[model samples]
Target: MILVLDFGGQYNQLIARRVRENHVYCEVHPHTMSLDRIREMAPKGIILTGGPNSVYQADSASCSPELFRLGIPVLGICYGSQLMAYLLGGRVETAPTSEYGKTEVTLRSGRSKLFAGVDTKTICWMSHTDYIAAAPDGFQITADTPVCPVAAMENEAENLYAVQFHPEVMHTVQGKVMLKNFVYAICGCAGDWKMDSFVRRTICELREKIGNGRALCALSGGVDSSVAAVLLSKAIGSQLTCVFVDHGLLRKDEGDQVEAVFGPNGPYDVHFVRVNAKDRFYQKLAGVTDPEQKRKIIGEEFIRVFEEEAKKIGAVDYLVQGTIYPDVIESGLGKSAVIKSHHNVGGLPDYVDFKEIVEPLRLLFKDEVRTAGRELGIPDYLVNRQPFPGPGLGIRIIGEVTEEKVRIVQEADAIYREEVAKAGVEGLGQYFAALTNMRSVGVMGDGRTYDYAIALRAVMTSDFMTAESAQLPWEVLQKTTSRIVNEVRGVNRVLYDCTGKPPATIEFE
Candidate 1:
C-alpha cells in the first residue's frame, strides 16, 4: 500500500485515486501524521500531496523530519516539492510569475526511474505560486521548464523524487505512467489492486460488521446509492432493507428503475421499500424559490422521511448512504473548505436515530464507483447512469417548485435524453433540460403565446466537479428543441445553455 500525506491539497484524494486506478491501493492521511503512525502503516511508498500553502510561511504545513529516514520511496508534488526542498537544506522562493495551467517540461539528463519510458519533452498541469530554486542536498535535477528551473529532482540513493508539475491530473498525458513507474520500478510494489478483490474483502467486512443486525439504505437511483444497496444486499441478504423515497422530484421512470434493480427476482433478491412522499415533499417545498433554501429543505425532509420509515421497520442498526470521495471532500471531510452540502454528505439532520452511518463507497470517486458497480454485476445502463443531485428536480427547476413546472421539465428532459441517445454522443457526461422559470412571447398558429422557456444543459466532463459545455452537433440540438417544443406540454421556446462550470454550474439552480 502507498500512503498519501495530505498537506491541505485540493487534489490529495485525486492522488490516492490515481494510485488505485493503477491497480495499487493507497490511503490519504494528513501531513501532520506522526512518525510513529507512519511506522505503523508501513506503506511501500509515500507521496506528499500539493497544497495551497508555502513551506516558508510562519505556520505552514510541515511533516516530521524523521519521515525521510523511513527508507521508502517518496514523491513530492508542487507544494510538497517546495516543502521537501526547504526542509532538506534547499532554496524555495516565490516565482516572478505564477504557473497556473499547462506547461512543458524538458528532461535534463540520465535515465530516471520516475520518467521511465516517458518522452523527453512532455506536458504537465502546473498550479503553484512558488518553485524550488535549488535541489536539496544529494538530489539531481531531472527536468526543467522555462518558468521553473528545478521542475523535477530526485535522489536515487534515498529513493526520493519531487516534481513541480502535477502528474495526477489528466492534462499530463503520461502522468499515470509516471505513477506506475514509481509504484512498480521505484517502490517495488505489486500493482495488483483490483475491484473484484475490493468487493470480496468489503463484503466479508460488512458481514462481520453488520453481524445479523439489519441495515436500512437510502437507495436513490443514482449510481452511488444503487451500488451501495447492491453491495449491502450481497453482504447481509434479507437483513438489509432498501428504502427509496420518491420525493416527486425524480426524473421519468427513476423509481421504476430502482425497483427493477432491487426487486425480488433481481440479481440480489433484496427486500425494498418504495415510499411515495410526493405530496408531502411538494407541499413542504411550495413556493420556495431560493436554491440554497430548497436544498436545505429537501435534505432535512429526506432525513425526516427516512427516520419515519426506520421507525416503521423497527430498530435498524445502521443507515447506509451512497457517499463517495468527492462528496466527502466537498463536504469538508478533510481540511478542504465546504464547496456545497450534498444531501448524502452534510445534509443529514440531528434527529437521525440509526446507531451508525455506513458509507461503503465513501473513499471512491464517481468513476471509481461505476467500476465497483460493474464489478458487482449491475446493469450497464444503471451503472453508467448520468449524475443526479440529491435535491432532484427541485434544483433542476431554476425557480419555485410546482407540479406543473416539474412535469414540464421532466417531459422536456426525457425528450432531450432520447435525442442525445439517438445521436450517440460519445463521452457526454450529463444532458438534461431545466425550467428557466421565465417565459417569452412567441407566435404559434399565428397567435401570440407566452410560455415558460426551457434551457437544455449538456456538459462533457470526466469529473463532475469541473465541466465544459458539450459541443453537441447542431442537428442533435435542433432535434431536441423541435421535440421539446412540439411534444412536451411546455407551450413554446427551447434554448441551450452555452456556459461552463466556472460561470455556471451544470444544474440551472
Candidate 2:
C-alpha cells in the first residue's frame, strides 16, 4: 500500500487516484500524522504532497527528519521537496523568479529510477515561490530547469526522492510515467489491488460492524448509493432497510425509475421504502435564492425524513450515506478551499440520532464506485447512469427554485439529453440543461415575449476534479437549442456553456 501524506494540498486525492490507477492501493492522511502511526500502517511507499506555505515560515507544516531514515521509499513534491531539503540540512529560499505553470525541465541523471522511461527534456507543471537552492549532502541533482536549479533531487542509497514540480497533475508531459516508476519500479509493489478485493473486504467489514444491528440506508438509487445498498444487503440482508427519498429535485421521471429497480418486486432482497416528499422539499426551499442555503436546507430535510423513517423501523443503530471522495474533497479538506458544499457532506446538519453515520463508498471516486457496482452485478442501466448530486436539480436551477421553474428546467434537461443521445455524442462526461434565472426579449409567432433562458453544459473529464468543456457538434447544439426554446415554455434563449471546471463547476449553482 502507498501512503500519500497530505500537507494541505489541493491535489492530494489526485495523487491517491493515480496510485490506484496503477493497481496499487493508496490512502491520504494529513501531514500531522504521527510517525508511530505511519510505521503501524507499514505502507510500501510514502508521498509528500505540495502545499501553499514556504519551509522558512514559522508555522509551516513539516515532518520529522527521522522520516527519511525509516528505510521506506519517500517522494516529496513541490513544497514537500523544500521541507525535505530544509529539514535535512539543505538550503531553501525564495527564487529570483517564481516558476508557475508548465516549464521545461532537463534531466541530469539518466539512471534515476523516478525518471526511468522519461525524456531527457520534458515539460512539467511548476507552482512554487521558494526553490531548493542546494541539495542536501549525498543527494544528487536529478533534474533542473532554467529558473529552478534543483527541480528534482534524489539520494538513491537512502531511497529518498524530491521533485520541485508537480507530477500528479496532467500538465506534466510524463507525470504518470514518473509516478508509475515510483510506485512499481522503486517501491516494488505487486500492483494486485482490484475492485473485486475491495468488494469482498468491504462486505466482510460491514457485516462485522453491523451484526445484530439495524441499519437504514439513505439510498438515492444513483450508482454510489445503489452499490452501497447492495453491499450492505449482501453482508446482512434483512438487517438493512433502504429509504429512497424522492425529494422532487431529481431528473424527469427518475423517481419512478428508481422505484422500479429497488422496490418490493425488484431483484434485490432488502426492505425498500419510497418517500414522495416533493411538497415538503419545495416548501422548505421556498424563497431560498442562495445556492448554499438551498443546499443546507435540502440536506437537513433529507436527514429529517430519514430520521422519521428510522423511528418507524424501531431501534436503528446506524445511518448509511453514499458520499464519495469528490463530494468530500469539494466540500472541503484539510485547509483546502471549499468549492461548494455537497448536500451529503458539508451540508449535513450538526445533530443526528443515529449512533454513527456510515459511508461505504466514502473513499472511492466516481469511476471506482462504478467498478464496485459492476462487481456486485448491478444492472447496466443503473450502474452506468449519469451522476446526480444529492440536492439534485435544486442546484441545477440557479436562483430561487419553484415548482414551475423545476418543471421548465426538468423538461428542458430531458429534451437536451434525448437529443445528445440520439446524436450518439461519444466521450461527453456530463451534460445538463440549467435555468439561467435571466429573462430575455424575443419574437415568437410575430409577438414580442420575455421568457427565461436555459443554459446547456457539457464537459469531458476522466476525474471530475478538472474538466474541459466539450466542443459539441454545431448541429447538435443548434437542434437542442431549437427544441428547448420551442418545446419548453418560458425559455426563449438557449446558451451553451463553453467554460471548463476551473472557472465554472459542472453544475450551474
Candidate 3:
C-alpha cells in the first residue's frame, strides 16, 4: 500500500483518489504522524502533499529526516518539494512571480523514471509561491519552466522525486501519466486494487466487526445510503433493518422506488420499515425562512425519528451511515476548512441511542461508491442516479416552502429532467429546477399573468468541487421552458442559470 502524508493541502484527498484510480490502494495521514507509526504500516512508497505555507517561514510544517532512511520511494509536490529541498541542504526561495494557475514545464533530462513517457513540453497545474533554487548534492534537475528554474528534481539512487505542480488535478494534461509512471514504473506496484477486492475485503471486515449483532440503517434513497445498506445486508443478512422516512421532501416517485428496491421481492430482502412523517416535518419547518435553520431542523428531526424507529425495531448495536470521503473532507476531517456542514457528516443530534456509527463508504468517493455498488449486484438505474443533497427540496426552494411551492417545484424539476433525458443530453452532469421567490409578468393568450419564476440549472463537472455551466442547446431549453410554463402551474417565466459553481452553488438555497 502507498501512504500519502497530508500537509493541509486542498488537493490532498484528490492525490489519494488519483493513486486509487491507478489501481493502487493508498491512505492519507497528517504530516505530524509519528515516525514509529509510519514504520509499522511499512508502505511501499510515500507521497508528500502540498500545503498553503511557504517553506522559508519559521512556523512552516516539515517532515522528520528519519523518514528518508526507510529505503522507500518518496514523491513530493509544491510545498512538499520546497520542504525536501530546504531540509536536504538545498536552497529554497520565494519566486519573483508566484505561479497560481496552469503553467508550462520544459523537460531538461528524459532519463528520470518520473518523466519516462512525459512529453518535452507539458502543462501543469501550479499553485506555489516558493520554488527550489538548487538541488541537493546527490539530486539532479530534471525539468524547468520560464518562471521556475527547478520545476522537477530527482535522486534516482534514493528513489526520491519532486515536482512543483499538482498532478492530481484534471487541469494538468500529463498529471495522471506522471502518477502512473511513479506508481507502476518506478515503485513497482502490482496495480491489483479493484472494486471486487474492496467488496470482498470489506465484507469480511464487517462480519468480523459486527458478529451476531443487529445493525440499523436510515435509508435516504440516494446512491450513498443504498450502497451502504446493500453492503451491510451482504455481511449480516437479516440482522440489518433499513428505516426509510418519506418526509415528503423527495422527488416524484422517489419513495416508491426505494420500497421497490428493498421490499420482499427485491435483491436483499432485508427487514424494512416505511414511515410517512410528512406532516411532522412540514410542521417543524414552519415559519423558518433561513436556509441554515431549515437544514438544522431537518437534521435533528431525522435523528429523532430514527431513534423512535430503532426502539420499535428492538435493540441494535450499530447505526449504519452512508458518509463518503468528500463528506468527511468537506466537514474538515483534516486541517482543511469546513466548506459546508453536510447533514450526514455533522447534523447528528446528541440524543442518539446507538452503541456506534458504522460508515462503510467513508473512505470512498462517489464514483468509487457506485463501482462498489454495482459489484454488490445493484441495478444500474440506482447506482448511476444523479447526486442529491441530504436536505432535499428544503434547500432547493429560495424562499418560504409550502405545499403549493413544493408541488410547483417538484413538477417543474421532473419536467426539466424528463426533457433533458429525452434530448440525449448526456454531457450535463447535474440538472434541476429551483423555485425562485421572484415572479415575472408574461402574456398567457392575451391575459397578463404574474406568477413565480423557475430557474433551470445544469453544470458540467468531473468532481463537484469546481464546475462550468452546461452549454445546452437552445432548442432543448425552449421545449423545457414551454412545458414548465404550460403544464406546471404557478410558473409564468422560466430562466436558465448560466452561473458556475464558484459564483453560484448548484442549489439556490
- Backbone clash total, candidate 2: 0
- Which pairs in model 3 have colliding backbones? none
Clash counts per candidate, in order, are 0, 0, 0
| Residue pairs in collision within model 2 | none
Q: What are the models' TM-scores?
A: 0.92, 0.95, 0.91
> For model 1, what is the alpha-carbon lDDT of residue 333?
51
lDDT per residue as tens, model 3, 1-509: 88999887777887888999989999999999998899999888899999878887888788887787689899999888888888888999888988877799999997889988889999998888888988888999998899899999998999999999998887778999999989998789999899899999999988999999999997988999999999999999999999998888888788888888887677668898899998898998888888877777888888788889989988889989898887777667676666666777766676678888899998888889999999998999999888877878888888677878889989999999999999999966688998998988888989999999999999987666556899998989999999999999889999899987654666676
Choose the strongest candidate by TM-score.
2
Tens-place lDDT digits, model 2, residues 1-509: 99999887777898899899999999999898899999999999999999888899999888889998888999999988998899999999999999887899999999999999999999998988999999999999999999999999999999999999989877788999999999998999999999899999999999999989999999998888999999999998999999999999989999988888899888888899999999999999989999999999999999999999999989999999999988988898886678889988999999988989999999998889888999999988888888888999999998899999999999999999999999999997789998988998999999998999999999987778767899999999999999988998898999989997665788887
lDDT of model 2 at residue 115? 100
Query: Of the pair 1 and 3, which is ahead by TM-score?
Result: 1
Per-candidate RMSD vs. true structure? Answer: 2.5, 1.8, 2.6
Alpha-carbon lDDT of model 1: 0.86
Q: Quote the positional error of residue 70 for candidate 3 in Å.
A: 2.4
User: How far off is residue 39 in model 2, in Å?
Assistant: 1.9
Tell me, by lDDT, which candidate is best.
2
Residues 89-200, model 1: lDDT tens digits: 9999999878877798898865999999889999988888899998888999999889898999998899999999989877777999999999999998888999888888
Residue 112 of model 3: what lDDT? 83
